[model samples]
Target: MADSIAELIFIPAPGVGHIISTIEIAKLLVTRDHQLSITVLVINPPPTFGSGSAITTYIQSLANTTMDRISFIELPQDKTRQDSKAPMAAFTDFINSHCKHVRKIVADKMSQPDSGRVAGFVVDMFCTGMIDVANEFNVPTFVFFTSNAAFLGFKLYIQTLSDNKNQDVVELSNSDSTISVPSFVKPVPTKVFPTICQSQEGLEFVLGSARKLREAKAIIVNTFLELETHAIDSLSKESTIPMVYPVGPILNLEAGAGKASSDDDIIAWLDTQPPSSVVFLCFGSMGSFDEDQVKEIANGLERSGHRFLWSLRRPPSDQTSRAPSDYEDPETVLPEGFLERTAGIGKVTGWVPQVAVLAHVAVGGFVSHCGWNSLLESLWFGVPSAAWPIYAEQQINAFEMVVELGLAVEIKLDYKKDFFNPKADKVTAEEIESGVRRLMEDNKVRTEVKEMREKSRAAVLEGGSSYASVGRLILDVKRNIL
Candidate 1:
């Protein structure tokens, strides 16, 4: 049986967040079916980013352990400078250029005897261009959407509407007008729409990908049915979209390998604090604030008077750079005497073992950028949050967490129009203090998160919604081979 196994090829977009989640999904697939093999085609990061090496190291470590069932092939470095002024345009162009390379790899793998039959292709949502390549090979293709279902529902709805018209219908004005999406009961504020929907180019890029998504055999989201039942139900009603699978909360279970720093000191600090007394603030890999914002955050922590463990990083030179930084002196960026005043009550570091810190008994609350991965981690650990979204789809995630899911306290719902622009109303120290206090002191929010936490764990266990979804996906792939 093993000798005649089928292989699945995965192509992930070029980012730490996308790459890590895609790798975890592949691991889950291989674990579920022993007769399955996976080959991940990794795209090279642009030369400017430094954290690409970390992703490479993480993938290599996984390959070393699962040598027989898993392997990787990195796309050649793209030396041609990305000419698109917008980030989405640049990423879309990059993925479009790799269809030929992926087609060749799929062809070569199918021809080799020991390589097994090429059963299908699993691509990251950003790499939907590869759907064309999969169609050429006459193999089933699945899209792994790394975010929640509400966002996916919104995308599918917008795509359906856009297909009917030749021009962009979404108004990009700065008003507080609301738009009704099919998934949510409440109308979404136009300002809270994804950054990609704010501009003509970004909208076109998203619409193009959404169109390609319709061609996939299935769409897999990194969320559970219990978490986003409304959104999942809404997407399921769409006849044009492919089958949807809620097979996740697929997290990086391993520690120490790809972490930016050792968590020994952070853990030691948490050990000294009382149970559920400290708040942990960590933005995602790309999350950082300007010096002004940092000073306000420092003041807010002091005013909140709660024990805190803040994983701080110097803001990047440019907004587009998502690279994690080397350790630096906090005094240079923080206000004078800020560290001295918060010494006993807080510990600030460049990076910490996020999972370990969140799992600590002392962690009562979280101040997060509301990246989907960070949000899931906080929920998985039963920690309530002060949602402070930074970039990408974070604002939408924050909105869903606070408004739709009832999981978190809102700090700023729509902070910015896009990454290139600053927030219209800067978040002040007073708002931060209020938000932190609400997350830490509110008993109802704490209890709700704890309940959600249990649900999250059960969803991934045997016979649970996420667990069954994974099984169904495996069976679906095997059925295709027959």
Candidate 2:
């Protein structure tokens, strides 16, 4: 008899962060069960923005190298709605527009005699609409949340509370008053809540996804059990949602492997520095600073009198653009003579291999934007962070890291307001300097982060929580197939 097969479908959103995380999960699933195969449905993003090229390249590389069991199918784009008012809106529109094509493709594949039997659909949290497609095909569906468990708990709790009064949570007052969330120890101050809670479109998007999650067979979060035990416990207790699976720290270490070849100059420079004496500053792909903020950061770095490696980029001309790719000359953005005076102690580049930098022994501090992926990488490497959130749900992540986890120092506790208001006051050089000093000087935060790093690494090892969670997920998929 022919070998039995278990195939799954993954529908990810149109950004680099989402695609990267989803791909990592797919790879992990296949590694854990050789009988399993993954068919990732890709959406053709507009030419101006999105991660189409990167995803295409990665899939092509996979086809030529390892992961032959994985395949990709790109959906045609709707040319009429290429332009959107915001990145979030654009992503939402793309998923809604292409979900029908995804369904058709999945159905066609299932009809083929030699094709593997479809067992499950793993949909990104942003692409939760695919759940309907899975239901139509009578396949079990799982929502892959590409964030921490605490954030998931926050979203579900807010949705439940808001439904009680038939009122939208985003429309609530943004005062300094605090509200209790299910899994958290202390009431979260309204000011540090997710920025989405302040916008109608964002709130609708989150609540809609949360509602969809309730119908899934299970929800897989990109976080481990030990990291957020309370949050995972809270989710597990809720009868409304599906089973919660904590299988994470799913990271792409390949980018770090070729660091010496791809970033020889930077690595060489770092080698000359003293042990644990350099600070590394890197925001996510979408992270950048205005001219004023750039100057302040330059001044702050110079004044801090520490060896530094800063990944600098100019802010996008369009605020709603997906990610910043334009590289600006350091002299153009930094204060006059700032580069010359700090040449001996600092180096600024357009982009660097972040994982490699964080893993290096010479690096001791990370000044980050508090994006979940970056935060995970920093923790995995045992580097203390100076939290500086920019957009999306980053503000909430920063607050959690500083207050709940005690693993990081805070630069701006409530930066979402300033991020949305261009004319808002910029963070001063003194504040940046103080934050950097505190992160580099504080031993308590460093010790805590080191312990978390060990836990993170241990969670993915053979006998770890994440390892067992992956096994459970694979077993669940196989049982569903039968």
Candidate 3:
């Protein structure tokens, strides 16, 4: 008998982090025995430049055999006279408006001779409009949440807030102290909620899309139940959709499969270092700080007197958010004469194969932006971290790592935001010095984090709940949904 074919459609939000998660899902499906096919549909900002657009190039570079199973579809870009200045809302509107285009693409693909039999749809959680397309095709669609189930449950609570009743989120977040969300599965700090949701319009947008998200056939969160059982259970009970699969630490598994790094020179440098002596610092694709904060971080690392590896990036010319204007030189982000001073102890690079660097023996601690991907990567390698969340749901993710899970400590920066012009003030040298010392000098804290690392590793292994759950998701999709 001929093998049954399964067609999976992917529609990721236009961001490097989102694309990375969507691609990982597609790749995982392929690794299973299913005869899988993927269609990546893009709707906003043209997906033509930056790390967001670079995903296409990376996909093309995948093995030619893999290329045969995946397809790309592009829609007409909307250049309407809209307020593109506000990125989050503008981007959300673009995705919602692309529903018609998305539906059209799915229809055309289904009609093609080589399209094979449609089975199930795997849509990014953010692309809630694609649910209608799946319904039209009479197939089950699962929402692949790119973050932890805790975040999703928190989002669900925020979605239920009526615009008329709750004009802004300030009431919810007035206290920096932890606020108990009435229906949420876990206790979350109001500060971790998205700042944009503080406004009425932003609240409406989030609530509207969230309702659409709840319409999926099933939900797949990229985190293990062992890591978030209570949150996952709460979400499953509340949602009408029954299936909630917690299959994660996915990056760790992928990284493990990667060949050992061939950077002999770098490895040699690390080998000479003492145990638990180096701090590894990396921000995700979108994480960037102003020049002042960058200098504070550099100075802090320098004063800590520890071996370090810091990955840095230069801001683009047209950038407004998260880009620093003062640092014109490529190396200006670093402290003055600091590179020479820490020559024997510090390594600065624009970017490195992050997973590989984290896996190195010499690396002991991580100072990170708390992006879910980076968080998982750090935990997988048994490295404790200093959490520094910059944007999006990072603060929320950081909360889980530090306060809830007891995996990492939060690094606070002192800055002021003017109502007229909101740019972060530079981080002071003292703030940097104290934060680094807390991580490197505290033995009791490091030991506790080491225990958490062991738990994280066990959560992803065979017979572990996460591994078993992923197997069930694949099998269920193939047998029932497909």
Candidate 4:
């Protein structure tokens, strides 16, 4: 019989960012070798909010080439109604309980005569339930963290959040400045620490996940070690095994494989503009802004004077809209007078071909929401950023990218008093102008940030850290599993 075809399964928590990253990983697994017949298993979440269903459609369309090699399974939705309070915990519980279903699916797949034996599994760190499924199959399971290495390291070591040594919340949040992590990371502000990584529940999840890391045969991060060598080194030293591999800036590499959907218009448009004259802005689907913040952003961009591309979506009901009337509303929306006033200088659209835009020579900097996908895209394109993180663990990511790595700068929001809330504070046109100007034109600032762009590009090239790690991961799978 022909050598058993290697079957690899991957499960990402439902989101475009996670789904897209997983798809790239799957593609790489096959492109690296012809012998592997890969199967990608996705767990579909409810369609009400942005879910994997949309991504499922997108991936299925790409399956014309893979045919029977790639397969998918949808999870049961949690329709049982409950109060919206503690939504985070509720959602986490729902996912945790879904492992039995995942296991059943795997068992059935293994029973087939022509079925490929499991070569390995790629489990999203958040979907720890997949660990049980991996254990049942007795395959080498690799945890795939779809975040920057610094962020992943912090998440893996989140137990530090429970320090009763400091009762002050302010002190705890800012501990990075005072507390030392030894030889690796330079101290940063606690104010930028992710709230999730700062809380008891969040800490428990992260630290517990670290323990699970000990059981896994490998841990793969979608980051290049050169970009986050200190944090990756720190994590490697602390872990039970040093099997951590940084095979990322993964999306760009996938793009290079010629598997990405073609969007030539993005390139055509960029050719018309002068070099480093455009600012591309977008937030992942999970991003949310109140009415006040939405309007503030619009006014800010309008005043920034740079040629711009803004991807605007319907802001949550609480957010204000000062969107101009000329732009479409609700869907395919843009503000009124948005395109006219900045006719030669701006293009406002609801969704954009982000990778293509960033790759354009005209694009100089980014005004980003700090989504990991966007972060990776920026690094890939060697672009600096104006970071405005909203919700989730983005604050932590922003700090690492900006304060720690110096690849981006923060757009600080000001309030009248000592007590401040992002929901209440407004970012005016003036603040926007200042931040944008600094990112695009400040000589000293621009020079330093430009160096980061060069470093980012070098990190993913042929002999680069990410390239070597991906090679090592593939070889390890071949030797240990196949």
**Best candidate, TM-score:** 1
Compute the lDDT for candidate 3. 0.68
Q: Which pairs clash inside model 2?
A: none
Worst 10 residues of 1 by lDDT: 165-174
Residue pairs with colliding backbones in model 1 are: none
The lowest-lDDT stretch of 10 consecutive residues in candidate 4 is 413-422
For candidate 2, write residues 310-335 as lDDT tens digits: 99976656633445654646688789
RMSD after CA superposition, every candidate? 2.3, 2.5, 4.2, 5.1
lDDT by residue (tens digit), candidate 1, 1-482: 53468789999887777888888888888888888889998787654554444555555454345455788887665568675457777767777788878878888877877677788899998888888899898998999999999988877777766777543555642456877888786787777777667667778887898888889999999999988999989888879879999987988856443454456677878999999999898887766777788889899999999999988887555544556564468778788999998998998898677888888999999999888988888889899998988777788888888987789998888876345564546789999999999989989889999999999999999999999999989988887666
For model 4, residues 354-451, the per-residue Cα lDDT tens digits are 77778788999888878787888887677888887765667767777777777787775112111023343566778777888877875654666666
Per-residue lDDT tens digits of candidate 3, residues 1-482? 14767777777765556666777767766765556667767544433233333344444433233345676666566666345545546666667678878778778877898666667677777777778778888888888889888778767777655443553464664446555653344567666676555555556567876787778777888887766767777776774544788888667344323323534555677788887788988877645566677788888888788789876765544533333222235376677798789889987765456777778888888888788888888877777888777666677787777777777776752122222125655656776667667767767667776666676667657778777887887777766433
Model 2 backbone overlap count: 0
Better of 2 and 3 by TM-score: 2
Candidate 1 differs from the real structure by a C-alpha RMSD in angstroms, to one decimal, of: 2.3
